[model samples]
Target chain A: MEPSDEALCQRVAKRDVAAFELLVERYQGRAYRLAWSIVRDPEDARDLSQEAFIRLHESAGSFGGRSKFSTWFYRIVVNLCLDHKRKRRWWKPWAGDAADDQGESFLERQPAPVTDPVDELGREQTMKDLWAAVDRLAPRQRAAVVLQVQEELATYEIAEVLKCSEATVRVHLHRAMNALKKTMKNMEKR
Target chain B: MAKHPETDLVPYLRGELPPAERERVARHLDECPDCRQDTDQLRELLGELSRSIAEPPAVNWARYRAELREKLEARRGRRAWWWQPVPLALATSLAGVLLFVAVWGVGRQVPTAGDPVAFEEAAIGRNLGLLEQYQVVERLDLLEEDLDFMSDLDGLAAGRPG
Candidate 1:
């Protein structure tokens, strides 16, 4: 039987490299994907996720069993990604084109739909526009939405990761959904 | 009609509402077409958002693990160097010297017996009681006049010349 994540985390606190390795293996994909969802840059995602793992190694002793290891770890990753976004925001005007080009490449690599071509194309456009709107959301709102839709965390769990109340998480989701709806409507009008 | 649970709609769709609140929202949805439409729209939008985010590009796990190991080793090495005996001793000595200098500097600022400022401060401290009784001192002339009047009364009471 595999040791639970909490058990592994305790061993990590003691510098058990094997246990740390297992934890990394379990969370690498999740951390990277969550980072990618927030920053929308592959290299930054990889670096931020790696940095989060380093932070976990350094601070594992402070875990204190207050929350699940996953939640604790996610807080680390989300904070790093949000910080990266904030630090990069000033230079984004110059970097925007490159990031968009990377996004286009990623979109092109997506598999084609097997369903009705016309409907899929329309839906695809809508999804693209919706994501673009998501990209423009306030950092915390964007983090809240990604944690909700992509990570599939519970509302309370998102609150723990965001270090905010559940009510605040709901407000974030509410505001995010309203913004996306408004964006979709404007796209339709255009 | 109940006020629309506009904020609660998202939580309701996500099944995050408490059972009683969930039931209330459900009944409200049954009675309210606009809210129901909003719920459906939210559900659809959330679904699309979830589906739209693509999987992250594949990473070479071995390379990543190796790089992390390298970085961790470097960090440990740096920490170890700081804790080594010679460097640790040097750091301790430097810290001790700094502490001594700080104490000496503070000690020099203390007012000594030979210091002019200390003499001035002592003079003020001794006169503080006198300064406190300034109002009584201001009435000294009145007290003197009263004493003279009493002396004259004593002379009259003794049947002496005023």
Candidate 2:
């Protein structure tokens, strides 16, 4: 039988890479997809999800098991996605830097040369408009909506992930759907 | 008592509603076009989102797993000999003590601004090898502060020219 997430986490606390790999295998899909849904960039999502695993490895020892392992893990992934989005939104291209594994500094990685967003729109209008509308929502609202529509998490589970009340999750989803509807309307006008 | 049952449309579309709440929202939707529009619009967005984001593209899980293992190993292996926690902690404590002693030593040498005598005494204590000459230096300093004695020296030098 596969070890429970809590049991795997306990082993991970002892620096067991195998245990961590199990945890990663179990959650990587949700982590990557949740990140992709929020950030909308494939590489960024991959990086963010991997970073979440790295973080889980580091902080595994500190896990008190107060919440379920998935809940705790999702919190880490969601926070990283939100932080990455905020950093990308405020960051300017070709200014400042963060270093990579090889100690090479890279300036902000944004405005990622869409070459022609219109070309993208022509290729997949439905997917493009849906993505654009989701992106238009506020971060938490976007997160709430994505968790609902894509992750298919119930409102209570989303509340656990978001660390908020179920009511607040509902409010966020309501606002996000409204905003998305408005965005779709505006896109049609254009 | 959720006054805004339209908020329930999201869960309704997701089929998360229980049978009773589902029936109630369904009945309400039948009566209200606006709520029906809400359900339809969100349903369309959810359909697209589910088709795309829900079904994430195939990731190279093998490569991803290998890279993550590499990173985990690197992170766990980061401490060189000098970076060992025990030695680093010991070295940090030693440096902290040395720094405190250096600061306190400096504080002792620096007399408060209002106390010239303490400053002189400290200077004298530091150069005890020059004890015999310190009195002479003090007298010379006093003489330099004497304007009349300086003017006499200036007059003498003016007369002598050399």
Regions of model 2 farther than 4 Å from truth: A93-124, A183-190, B1-3, B6-8, B12-33, B43-48, B52-57, B79-83, B106-162
Name the weakest run of 10 consecutive residues (lDDT summed) in model 1 chain A.
A97-106
Model 2 docking tier (incorrect/acceptable/medium/high)? acceptable
TM-score for each candidate, following the candidate numbering? 0.74, 0.66
lDDT of candidate 1 over A10-119, digit per residue (tens) = 99999999999999999998999999988888888988888999999999999989899999999999999888876786577565422332332333333443333247
Q: Each candidate's iRMS in angstroms?
A: 1.3, 2.5
By lDDT, the best candidate is 1
Q: Show pairs that collide, candidate 1.
A: none
DockQ of all candidates, in order? 0.46, 0.30
lDDT of 2 by residue, B1-162 (tens): 225486788877777788999999988888888787778888886776677653556799989899888877787677556588888999999999999999989887677879999988887778988757879988887988796677878988889541
True contacts kept of each: 0.72, 0.59
Minimal lDDT window, size 10, model 1 chain B: B104-113
DockQ versus reference, model 1 = 0.46
**Model 1 stretches with alpha carbons more than 4 Å out:** A91-117, B83-90, B105-162
